[model samples]
Target chain A: MRYLLTIVADGMPEPEKLAVLQRECPRWVHEMDGRGVRLLGRELDPPEATTTVRVRHGETLVTDGPFAETKEFMAGLDIIECANLDDAIEVAASHPVSWYTAIEVRPFAGDLHLGEAAAAFARGDACGEPFLLVTWMGGTPATPVHDQAVADEGDGWRRDLDRRGLHVLGDALGRPDTATTVRVRDGSTLLADGPFVQGEDFIASIDVVRCQDRQEAVELAASHPVARHHAIEVRPFCNE
Target chain B: MTVKPDVRQAVDAAFRNEWGRVVATLIHRTGDWDLAEECAQEAFAEALRRWPSDGVPHRPGAWLTTVARNRAIDRLRRSERGLQLHEQIGREAMLDDITGGSTPVARAREIEDDRLRLLFTCCHPALSLECRVALTLRSVAGLSTAEIARAFLVPEATMAKRLTRSKAKITAAGIPFRVPPAHVLPERIDGVLAVLYLTFNEGYSATSGAELIRTRLCDEAIRLARALHELMADEPEVTGALALMLLHHSRRHARVGPDGELVTLEEQDRDRWDCAEIEEGQGLVEEALHESRVGPYQLQAAIAACHAGAAAIHDTDWAEIAGLYALLEDQCPSPVVRLNRAVAVAMGGDIDAGLAMVEALTSDPRLERYYLLEATRADLLRRSGALGRAQAAYARAIPLAPTDVERRFLERRLAEVRATGADESGPRPS
Candidate 1:
């Protein structure tokens, strides 16, 4: 359920290595944490400062260097608790070093005794709120349906949700170009921009609701008017 | 040095994801499934050594397969048995008869032929209908046995055995991986079209996924259908399958909400529908209908065309759809088809007739546990003012519904009936 992703950034010596870890790793870690995956990351001292000793025939053989003689050394590690290996792998694979240095993913071997810290990391438990995010292109409202038309046509949906004691959150009318664009340049600082790369249209709004998982959230969102025209992106919120 | 963990993970993901496509291309080029798979594996192994340092190539599959093929050739030169086969193949290569290219499109075409070959081989007359479907889904559609089992609501182990037996039959009967002769093309093409249609349907309305629609799967199925259409332009069913896929896909944008929730057809915004795809699909339907010889696919396409042509839910020609469903039943009489036909009949104002048809289908063993069937019957009953029966039907349907969304929807229907306190509904649920 939990994996420690150890990214070994070997060859690149000096401040460049530390800079990459400092700037890139935190952003990636924050994104994962935002998605409800508990993350704890730290940078380790260089391998040269580390010591490894082997005992054979009651004799100790001490080595001044690291265990593996690879260009990249174990620079840092991020501990992530996920629902399953697949989920963990998705997170690990998205790390900055996934495309460059070697990332070692090892499952947590045993249960942890975190004491009071565990409660602080527990995810939120809000669920069963029905909401529809209707996205409109060019900042336009959905087709003018008389209150009667919606009450008539969407009666089935309303009746269904009402029986379940679920109430739809009020709709958001998004700006013409509401998306915030971020670009990772030269594997460093992210460049922020306005409105997703100009296309035929832009994402108008996002419907947010409290649900159990992606599947439930998606199904509930599908009934919204905006989904009929624009793309829908689903992301679960961290309970905390 | 031990392989870097990140490199290992990337290689593994790439292997799992790209292995099939690479093997498919190699199998077509080499004309040997086992050898192509081996070559593809070898190529990936080489990538593990080089990619971390040099960075991944722009076209990884092409690079991997080329390296593997060259490695295979070098190995062949070193072996006595391989040398003889290599010489024969070399002669064919010298003759300039074999197609050679490294582009993805060219490789895809080769793989497409292999797909056609696999389709025919899987649907060989010796195989049972279930076996054919399982084999086609596994080999051609690239679905795992577990995925196929989930689709058919069967145990994974049983499905795996079924796949094994189907493969064994192919081997024993010497079913060559090639298209059947022209004389038998019509019937064989039907099997191929059915398999493709099923694949597309599964993708368009995934039985279980966080997303309502799996666009990748839909795209893949459409691409396959298009290839079949191109190969057999004279075949009416091929045209029909392509038309149906286009028409259905044209509604994909309107099928989900901005928050990724499911959307029922009646609530969909008509202006959002892709008009270009609709136009293209309409053209194909017209051509297919002109053939005079009606098939199940063409009939289904006709039905979809009716829905697509409508300006709004009220404007839908329910009578025409009901008529098309009647033809479809005559061509392929299944409980599911009849159930859908009942809805059309109800929409056409023949509520009594629709209710009767639905009631008849409830007794069908094939539909006893089918949630949609119960839901359909409940809708009819509720419309006819039979609240007690409708409530019971909805309750029965709740347990059978697979997804939370469907269950929630059904529960809502049940509540409405209860709230009305046995009053007959004004209009039937669509």
Candidate 2:
């Protein structure tokens, strides 16, 4: 199983704590990577530096600030492949931030390789790959004929992307209710079963694909087989 | 002036009926929600422009779908980007899929399935509860952003952002658009039903605001539930949910006094209840009960039916109502449900037992902020002839009441309790 380790703190840590994070984060990443567990890791810019983009009724709307506003600020994130949730918990606990702040380990809804698209980012090879997060929104129970069409038509689009190496990773997620949320608090590793975000229109499946730009991303998103009867969104990872 | 009034009316009606279908179909073919919505909106706009001159098409849904598909294709072809997306059209979806190309029965079945899929997607649990409500109203029910925003008391921009945020999350999270498979269908259907019920409740009693009722939201919820019942006729909970809404909505008129004071069910004028709605709701409750697959809504509807059937408050079967509530408590199990069951138990007979039940509930931290707990205790105390205790309970409840109308009602009860220091019956009926 793959889990996303989200490092968060109540606010900016003291400078000495920052120096400790800067000192420990790389060592932690190197160790995880040495173990072939870390697929990707990045220290994000602050929330103020974040930019939120949304396409509504075909119009691209851009706004300043993070995708969501909350008190606890996300400082960094890492994607790690683990044997099971217990192993993932051990890995999170090893991180220095877990002792002082908070580290949330959430599994991806599906298979993904964030490193696959590192070259295609808008900022070019200077930064990581800019992959469009193709989320397959909700769909109704498929009619017999519709399912056949998807098997016949949908796989073709995905395969073509794969053949060109544009498609990185994709798969359906476990049910949201099956989701397990983990947190390290007061020297205790607390575990709860639920997604981090409490939102409507949950994720059904996801695709990570390299796209030329937002227009191409939208176009590509529009072409998924399930996109016919369902909702789909094409967004870039923030670092992109 | 070229637009005939009838043509305009026809287009408006078709937009209401066919907008969801057209949009869903276009999105399926083109693989773009924006394109689908834009094309569907344009199709209606086109109909308003062309219907008078072209004569009203025999099949307005088919006509609208064809126009939307054509627009989607045109827009795709014209857009500078998307060589692959434009190539996506090469697969060539059957245009008649939206129109139900085969037999009439097949067409109706397919269209309904599409609507159901949209509903499930709109009500997916991944989205926040608010987003689920907003999306269902907007995407599935075809309410505009402005209208939905107004109904929810959010700014139009905020509603627009919410819709965009929801759609983005759907794609970002990969929420499938289909109805959940058999294994998860029970829970997913329950989720959909919850959204509609919550919507109805929000309108029936504005939880936070001063307004006692917001019928528009209640109407929207019923409209959606009615449609859901049609789509999933075999789902007893859907039928029960619809029945419950109808039964509760039936009392809208009598629920408030002439001066807009909130009236307790016992104090409401029974003659003012909408008889036609009660009859329809009662019929639905009967039909759902016949399924023998009782859920929370079925139990609730049964309790409401018990009340609706009675000619006078005193004539009502409180014991039966209490029994139904017990079933409901077993079904969902909430402090609020327990509170309601206590009221019914008191009405049935044993005041002391009911008071004990109510008294024990006070310790629950969850009910600490729930004003109804205090109010219920006050009512039971008053009934048991503990006027001073009842007065204190009522005064405590008045401050905790969420709305002014409810607060004023509590005040009235408090005054009545205070005035009647000594009564042989030992309590004043509110």
Candidate 3:
């Protein structure tokens, strides 16, 4: 199992404290990596530099800050490959940041990037490699005839993916009527009731697919049933 | 109420103590708050049906936990949406066993930490204050929405709505179920203390009831506070809040007389105070004060310590109490703090000065219907030889008193003033 450790802190620590933490963190990171536990780690920019974008209904909601209102922001993150939760906790607890800030440990669903999907997915393994986000966009609303075709098509695609042992995640989003848009400007949150951009077709579904390379990602995206009526955008994530 | 069997009683007790932990553990496992609560409730309901026949499990918490987790598994396997939740739990189970090699004992400890995480999440500062209080009482103290509504004197529907909104917000906003980091912990700690203190105060001084105290709520509040203190012992405010609660609770026995009349602190028998509680509270106060952060809770605890340290009313260090209240006012100034300070000043020595202070607050709208303002004014006026005005003030305050005990106490003062014919004397005799 791989675990993601989110290091949350209020603003940033003072220069001296940050310096001390920075000095100590690398040593522990090296220790974990040397022991074959650490997979990846990165320090995030300050919250002020963050831009949050949400698409609901049809409007694109963008904010200058993180989605959650909190004094403590995600200062950094680390992904560690461990045996289990107990192993994950042990690895997490050893982080020097845990002393000053909270270390949130959450297990990775699967090793999407490792391209071990065929074997692991057959075993129902949740932990794997890297994840590529496959978004199905701009599909026509289903009518009586279209509904059966869509369902039949979707089932066939699902079975094919399952047969190939491809573990994908995500659910289809509801129509624009059920959507809501939230945007923040100049520290004031402006909420528009209806879709800001109106169209018959919109983002219908999203899935995190395990793929080792661009070719594999594109192949998986092309295999989706929705690709016949909609565009599938395959974006590879830089980190877990 | 019919008498319950021993096994049933034990199950009931276990439910109160273990409900939060069970739910927290399930939430930690599945990351689904609604499902966790639902499964935990189902487990408790199952316990009720089976415990009578099974004669109660040796470890009721463990039994309920196992049953709850299994129930969650069954539900997830059967439901479409729960597929993801089920998968997460399955992965976690595998991880737990394969990685660090968790034993039963280690798992139990993890569950304990889950409760703390749940509490911190429930009391997160991001939630509204009312939402925080309702969530804390429901999630941490394991009180029903209706029960919390009754305790807080709100309608069941309002409380239910408040609780639902808060929970939805928590889920939608992705508030992690964990304690906040050090820098942010102080603000979050304050939010938690506020909820605990509100719980304690509701019990210490019932806002509206025939009785002045509700020991059950008080006990629950103290228990929750102690648990928080144990989990975060280094947090000075947690220690300070616990100390403050203990010092006030030590006087619980003497707070009311045999006739169920409110007993003024000065008139209550000092010997009746719980010495053990006072000693422990004083120790905590010293410990917290030494740390030098000096939060509002620590200041209030110091004032309580002043009263607890005194052997008698005269022995009480009114000046020190007044000084502490002043510092408290500086930190969080309010009409209530000034009112308390005035009383302490009057009890310390200068009745005339206290009366002037009380008079100054006459036009403050917030204190207009505040019974303490009227009661304090009446007391100070009676002591300063203004019987007519004192009797009128007492008359004005009696109707405002929330509890019958306070009303009776005020009526007695009115009778005392009428009988004495306006004598310039000290506080009315009990």
Candidate 4:
């Protein structure tokens, strides 16, 4: 995971804090370099030079300064890719500039080209590429197609995924013969049984398919339906 | 061919300058203090063996650290224990994406944290004060247990047990390795300064060595004091301790002879004294005094300043020294302080009063085994024209003395009393 450490150094005399950084940054950079870790660092101009723009309803709106007004302003940042949040935090916490400035560490969003809605789903896949897994869940219809029970069938699907270089993230048994769902709109609410909204068949459990994109995810989800009329919902989870 | 003395001196200098840095950097890379120290030592041994043939490397500290790191990694891959440690570290290494990012200063500082943590761990309160002092001298100051024991006038076995008990207590209590917070810094400073002072005193007047002074111990104590000052300059007591040490150490060059015999304070050539150290010590003392908070060290510095300020023995302000000793006695109240006060009193021409005070200390239990008490008493007796009694007192002191230098000084005094043949009962003329 990549962390963006936004250095916020407000209220400190600019020159004094800058001098500290000047003396400390070279040492810090050399230490990290010795460890074979390279980081991207940038110093931003003053807050007065900052501008924000947004296009909404086919109109462009420009603001005079940053997106938010706060006492601690972002003066600079370093992009560090580390093993986990812990490692990222360790690096950021030890930065020489951290003594005077606050380091706001946020994990970099993956799939930068994707819009917010799509990115949320795609980002998890992007982050979890190394450890992605595919499997199926839920009980089969009451037919004598195979001797294995629904739970056993799920285990079989997991074994098959494992054979294909995929691993099971998690699995759970569906609730015994009952399920509940709820929907809310405006100030009103609705509740139903049989998997909500009088669906043709109940979704006893969910199959979280690990794939690289929506097409692969849809394809994986298609092969796991318990009944002919049943439907599956595809969602994403991150391993990073 | 034998290695040139200059080459040996150069290598020794390199080791003194870079030992800590090399150990620190290696510890960062290796993540083990004991292993890092061993690895650094191995690298130095290799340098000693090869530098004579291949010549010394430029940037020797960096070269040594890099060589040690690589050797540690190679050794780790070769041994089962090393393999296990490597596996544990390798998991983290595999996931580390921000490589080559930290600076040498940061790495050195990180390694120094280990040393600081070792100091605190060695000084944990579960151990007795003796154990804490011994272990701190051994682990933090890097002195041997034998050296520490000699400094404290204890048997080597006793010191070894003290160190073992300290380490056991630390293990039992599981003291976390860290620098103490500001709240506990005073206590930590107290422990560190006590060890430094003891180490310096041992060097100033060695216990059993043929030589009167151990310059190695003196240099090590000075280095440790400097390190403490660097680490905690804001603490007034640290500055006071440094000032006290510097003032006393400024007289080192004038304290001995070419034949390695001790020189009495009055006979020491004032011109041979270190002027730079005297000036720096004065500056430190002034700064510490400005804080206006009096402590034992500040009192000692004041006393030392009295001596350093004098151009000759006659010009020494013994009265001011006596006053500072009195203040120090109130602040610390040790028998040693009172003994020092008597010396000042004698120098100020109250010889009879000083003799009375030294006589009274004979009954003090804390000083019963102390040779200095008898030695001081003999000086008073010699001054009062009691030659027979003074010679006998000197004889009593010789057996109790720990060092050859002290024994030699006592022998000389005894010979002086024998040669004088003055009236044994009456006070002598000044």
Candidate 5:
């Protein structure tokens, strides 16, 4: 089991103690690495460098501070793979920071990477290769005929990109009203007749584009006729 | 056929010992939790029905596993999901050997690993603490959701929903069902031990436990701990946990009065403590300490051993216990540990110092609502001949007690303090 060990400081350490911990931190990492428990680790910038973002009322809201209201803030983090929960706890307990700060050992939620989704759709083992999931966020609600014409044009463009190994998959979702949302709460499953989140604008379509970098993805995405008028978003597809 | 008494006994024992193994191995083959559980349940039912006539199998665990696997395969063969048929038939080739009634050596070794996988996955930190406890009992300990709900004091429906939601998360999120690779085993030990300890605590402290099922949780936890010990004997913390539980469990009979009220340790009957359990716990703790493995549980077991080894309250080695608690306080740093260390320090002949420590701990908001803090302070005060302050502190503590037994314990102390201070009828105006 892979656990993310988050090291948070209750308050600043004494300068002398900080100096010792700074020296000891590398030795801790090195020992863990030798034991094959520590996979990766990084020291985070202080909370002053934090930027929090949220999308409320269809507008992106950005703030310049940590997201949570706690005096204990994340100081650093290490990804350590333990055999089980007890091993994770022991690792956190032995950490040098544990003497002065708290190490919150949390296991990552099970691997839900895009590879599984690709397998579900029988995406022809294309998951191992790099691909970006580009989607249409929201724009003017076009009639079915107009959408069909655009989709047909997109098919031709997709086939052209496929010849160059840049296109992997593409699809248009049904109208937002056709979406159903499910939530289990209070020992009952509640079914609501709409998308999980209601909005005047909704995701209308998505496509997988193979690319090496975001710059190339953006350049490739900009070539589609839909990007000229409608809002198109390009995101990095998770790679195995 | 009705099950004969002896046959029923054997079946029950098999169910307790082999349910986790059967379900774990079946789930490994089937990749379906509900199917594995259902088939395991059916396999037990089959044992109850057939064992009396069939004279019980030579190896009931292997027989049950073979039965459960066959049932799972039958269900899959009947299903229309062809995509998984090739993958889910992992045990189809081994069933013939298992059915022949002679266990293969390689397959026998896999049983322990399979159970550890199930336990680790159930107690995964990604789940909420309550979810982890609930899942561990249901999946690894083989408790029914209804039984678990009643033990946890929640409605059966709520418990069912919790189990369903957790299982769905496990399936949807692709939580792998395998033991973590060997090197980080030390790192993962505490979480597994914590769930077992919490399970034991839930049963141990239920003073007015109104249900037989609720009180059985202590036995269930110890059984699981014993099972864990058999699997991970090398882990000191695991051994420490088992030792600590046994030491505390050895004193259960002496912990309550005849009227079912809580009895202070000093007032308890030492002769009533089980000697065999004490010996076992002491042996385990000694072995762990000899190995130089001093985790929190081991430290606690060592302290418990001190109390168990004392023939009388006065004979208890208070200084040694105080030292152990100090080390625990430094290592695991909790207000409860500090409170315990204060009591130990006072018992070790420093009443004033203990009182000062308890008094300073009062400003800590965490201890404000804790009744033991005031109780300990009052006890120290009473011993120091400060009757008025002792009486006042006892009165302050009585209402803060969580259970009726503790409340009455405090009230008795208050009355005793009042009897000593005849000059003042009330609390001496705080």
Candidate 6:
């Protein structure tokens, strides 16, 4: 369970105590975060720096003091994940803030109104999303049998994609042995017989597939038998 | 209004043997120190209440374990932490092997292993030395806060607060409740062994009090060391340390005379020594030496073995013992080790060599106030026929001696030197 702990304190604390807190609290925060207990925390500006704006019936009314007149104000806040309420209390009690101030803990509901795209992204659901998979193969010479195996593996992947109704469009390019690079510099055209950059591997194929999300595309690419000895890079298409 | 004597004895015995196990079992299952300790204590309290009328259970440890475990389960079920416990238990699958289709014997073994792990956790090197001692006494020895405070001569509230801080740090720092891995074993074992040795020494020769030995503290240290040796049978130093303590303790029966005067090793009655303990300690020393990788503790054990194995002081192999002390000094150099080496060298018939070593130690500020330094020098001087210097050294040491027994011993040596007329004409080193 996750809880937000609001550190409530009166006006300003003693400077010596504050100095001690400044030196030690951040270390505690880092330690708690390392333990995976604390998710995030931040110190808020003091009450004097607070600016409160009230929006009533679309009319904005600005005020000096942050909230209502109360005995204490929120000085800082921490979001922590714990076992449950008791565990959350335990974590909260360990905080240095609790030494001199109150730690108000409450359950965190998270943001519930994120739009469809963002919601899907948060859930890791790539439904109806498209991606491009760039298949890499060796530029090094291979036997005819190895070449045939690569072709057979690609075909098997295409068939599996078709069965899953995720196939969109894909193509196997000619070997890097037949590739060329063209460049124009200072109104002069230059040509090369191979890739411009020298590396052990080259792009051998490209696949455009529509799936639930990038996760599904990654799964499909990983399942491709060519990925056993080669590499498959799956990139989600950003349609803007 | 009266508690039955038999029931009280059973409860006390059970608490001594079963406290660590019961607390360990709960801590292993729950991962909550406070909860485990509280529930275990509650179980003991319940035992005290019911055992008289309800009759003692056939298997007291198991009964206590079951009752404490049930109490922990109840606490977990009602608290939010219970869900975390379940999740943790599920992930680790720690209880699965024992709880799922295991024999009663296997379950018993697992609980005993938990107690050993608990000791390691309590004596972890990450904790401060004082904290480690306090935690081990409380968790492993089943000493109450008041008892611990009284033992160490601290306030009860202070001891309680220290224990609370240590537990908080254990949880907050995520110190694991298990023995360290083999690679880190030596350093961690040093920490554990140091605690056990200190505990034993405090009991063997208490810093304060009229009594020379507190038998309970020595017993607890020996018990803990024996358990550690059992768990880490392959670690030679563990065996060495256990052997060293056992050998020293074997002579405890003869260490002090009937008049409560300090009995030097040469004057001690070998017939009063524990032959069984000497045999066990000698066996351990032999096995540890066979490992070939010697440590400080192993070297010290070998030295003790020479003393214990000998029938009399004349039969002792001082040369071999001196060689072992040299090896130990090389492994860990300290004034105490050097002093011991000097004594062994003198006993090995190299009196001048021992006198030279003690003279060199006179300039060391660390040992300036140490009474043993002066005492050892006094003995060496007396052996070399420098009776005047020996008497002066004994006078200096007698005032600096921490214990009454050691003071009396030094005074006796001073009287012997004066009576021999050697103090009248010998030149002083000054």
Best by DockQ: 5
Q: What is the RMSD, in Å, between candidate 5 and the native fold over all Cα? A: 10.5
**Total clashes for model 4:** 20
lDDT of each: 0.62, 0.73, 0.70, 0.61, 0.72, 0.72
Candidate 3 DockQ, CA atoms: 0.03
Q: Encode model 1's per-residue lDDT on B164-251: one tens digit a residue.
A: 7665444322345677767557767876776677767767775356232255457656876786787678888899999999999999
- State every prediction's TM-score relative to the real structure: 0.51, 0.66, 0.61, 0.54, 0.69, 0.62
Off by over 4 Å in 2: A1-240, B2-9, B51-56, B81-86, B90-104, B207-213, B422-430
**What TM value does model 6 have?**
0.62
- How does candidate 5 score on lDDT? 0.72
What would the DockQ be for model 4?
0.01
What digit string (tens of lDDT, one per residue) describes model 2 on residues A27-145? Answer: 99789989988776656556665444444454445455654456765566666778755567678877888867667665665455454353233124533244444343333432223
For residues B330-415, write the lDDT of model 6, one tens digit per residue: 98899889888989999989998888998899999999899999988988888887788888899899999987878888888899
For candidate 3, the lDDT comes to 0.70
lDDT of 4 at A185: 31
Model 5 per-residue lDDT at A72? 70
- Model 1 gets an lDDT of 0.62
Worst window of 10 by summed lDDT in candidate 3 chain B: B91-100
- State each candidate's chain A TM-score: 0.42, 0.63, 0.49, 0.43, 0.48, 0.44
**Residues A12-111, candidate 1, lDDT per residue (tens digit)?**
6467765776587668878987886854444555556433333333333444554334465556545666654334545655676664554644443233
What is the C-alpha lDDT profile of model 3 across A69-137, one tens digit per residue?
556555665666665433454565567666565565544323423344433432345454434332334
Provide the lDDT at B2 for model 1: 74
Give me the TM-scores of chain B across the candidates: 0.73, 0.91, 0.86, 0.78, 0.94, 0.90
Q: Candidate 5: lDDT of B404?
A: 92
Query: Who wins the TM-score comparison?
Result: 5
At residue B313, what lDDT does model 2 achieve? 90
Query: How does candidate 5 fare on TM-score?
Result: 0.69
Interface RMSD of each: 24.5, 8.6, 11.3, 24.0, 12.3, 26.6
